[model samples]
Target: MNLAAAHPGFLSPTGVEIVFVLVGVVTLAAAVITVTTRKLVHAALWLVVALGGIAVEYLLLTAEFIAWVQVLIYVGSVVVLLLFGLMLTRAPIGDSPDADSGNRPVALAVALASAATLVTVVVDAFRTYWIDLDASVQGSTAVTGESLFRHWVLPFEALSVLLLAALVGAIVLSRKDGPRAAGPGPVRDPDATGPAAPAAPDQPDTDTGPGSGTDAEGRR
Candidate 1:
């Protein structure tokens, strides 16, 4: 019944929208893997993929500065720091038995509740609002910077401090203790000449005393 004519952009999305949906799906899958993986390194790598997808979404939304910031901060710096922390803590390279504590059902329930809450909140907030693709809403660096520093300055600073604290906590947790004693080793006598050099292993009486030795021509 002419749905494209009735709803216009909603029914007939552009190529950007198609790409956005694809990216969003990929991001969601990566996020699920990030949370559910049994290996921490795999989870961190999946987190990078998810964050990279979000950055691509931002770029698709015409926010290049935010996209780059997302890539630089989350994907680059944060993931590298996370990998370093994992290395420093001697985390397992393969599947970590401690990663999943047999609480999958409970965790899944909590995750579903959180997702529902978030979806509800977002839907309620933006149900009646819509942005036109033809609008000239400039998402420039200056505007973004002003908005960040003016209205969200306190939260921004708080986030930075939070990240700093998290980094410090990671370092603290990954720091190793002093070397441990490897138990008592074989004790040697200081006055002994290294156990008499093992008595030369009893070389078959090769030199039959001083005169009984055989010459190079086999003559005694």
Candidate 2:
């Protein structure tokens, strides 16, 4: 018996497949807009949509734990932190002319090459693999948690450290220097002669004989 005949073929997609395709389209559109939009804030918002769509796709794949984790970590924390950083840095709210570098063609070519490589790799790797969604929970909380902590714990902790360092670096970069501590008065030349003659004491006014007489009655 052919293994391919043991399951539903791709020609007749199930409801989950249909929903997944729809969500994937929306996610792709959002991602495209996120990259192509000239407004930074709009791009950030569109990224939220794209990320949320991915979380939805995860949910459709029956990975409930991973879906919630994606929502909380990426949609809730990461996107919110990104928007907060933008606000803190006082990023341009309107259309930013500097949003695009002068290397669009080069960037597009690189992006296309990277995308093609990734797609080819993923398709080649999973072309024959199939998941039985109805059989059992493939990614429950316990299973995912165990796998993560058991096998990927070191990398996970390292990523956390890297994120913390990035957050600190962002804070340091965004901070405005404190009004430079009032500069310790002006610097004095080490070779200056004497104590600068105490600024010459105010000279006492001398009376110009009888013609310079000033009376208390305001007559001079």
Candidate 3:
């Protein structure tokens, strides 16, 4: 007997499935726009939409913990940091001519090839696999915590380190590349390498004596 025919409820599409499909489509569209948009700020905003859609999908899958984590970590923190970097770097807010280049065809071909490879791999891996609703595997808080700490702890820590490094790098790269402007003090010459030479003291005029003026000009 066919499993799908035996389980009629599983075969039937529900309102949840329809909503999921709609959200997935929106997510895909947002992701495409995020990558293709010429305006950096608009691309960042579109990325928020795409990330939010993924969080919603997680919620639909009954993984509330993961969904909230996604929202907090990716949508909230990461994107905000990205925007902060953009602002600090004084990036252009409007359409940028350099955003798109003449190698668009080559990039598109590479993207399509990567996507096709991913799809083929996934199809081959999960073609006949089905998840059981009653299985012990779950996305509960305790289970997620255990799975993360017990199995994926090192990778998680590494990712945190990576993010920290990226943040530091952004700040470093955005900083002005010269000495800070002098405040209310003497302006030091930036090109001077050694200690400043002592300014020559003013010398009193030896030729302007009391009698020297009379000799040069008797009329005076």
Candidate 4:
């Protein structure tokens, strides 16, 4: 009688399968939009959608811990940090045309090639594995995290160092008096404009008329 308990949105077997397909579709669409969106904030929103789709997939697979982690690490921390960076750096409020470049064709080609390679590898590797969806899934945040730290300690530390370095770099670069010697900065577009007026040669030694050059000329 109660459809909510019997065949909820995505908890039932059939619903899970259908939702997986939907999630895949939305995830792909979000990926495309994340890249193609002209606005920086819009791109960030699209990334959130993509991440949410990942969380949904994890949940459908009964990996609630991983799903929450997908939301926490990606949707929460990473996106928040990105938006913070955008805000702090005073990015243009209007559409950021250069947020991405004009190299869409190249980017798309690279993405397609990567996707094809991934598909081939996955298909070849899993051609014979029978995955039983009835299998019990463990969703332990602590265990997975411990395993990650234990196995990939070096890469984990490296990533932490990388993130710290990036934050420090952004702070240094955005400082009012950025990290640079107190010297004249490089010239911009020198050929685009007329040559700068030649610096005046060091003026010849000047004299204060009578007594100024007394030591030089022995004139008292």
lDDT of each: 0.72, 0.76, 0.73, 0.69
Q: Which ten residues in a row have the lowest lDDT in candidate 3?
A: 192-201
- By lDDT, the better pick of 1 and 2 is 2
lDDT of 1: 0.72
* Candidates sorted on TM-score, descending: 2, 3, 1, 4
The estimated TM-scores of all candidates read: 0.62, 0.66, 0.64, 0.59
Candidate 2 wrong stretches, greater than 4 Å: 1-3, 117-121, 146-220
If both were scored by lDDT, which would come out higher, candidate 3 or candidate 4? 3
Candidate 4, residue 207: Cα displacement in angstroms equals: 46
Better TM-score candidate (1, 2): 2
lDDT of 4 at 11: 33
The alpha-carbon lDDT assigned to residue 87 of candidate 4 equals: 62
Q: What range of 10 consecutive residues in model 4 has the weakest lDDT sum?
A: 203-212
Candidate 3 residue 20 Cα shift, in angstroms, is 2.7
Better of 1 and 3 by TM-score: 3
For candidate 2, the lDDT comes to 0.76
Q: List the residue pairs that clash in candidate 4.
A: none
lDDT of 2 by residue, 22-129 (tens): 999999999999999999999999999999999999998888898998999999999987886676445789999888899999999999999999999998776555
The C-alpha RMSD in Å for every predicted model, in order, reads: 17.9, 17.9, 17.7, 15.5
**lDDT score, candidate 3:** 0.73
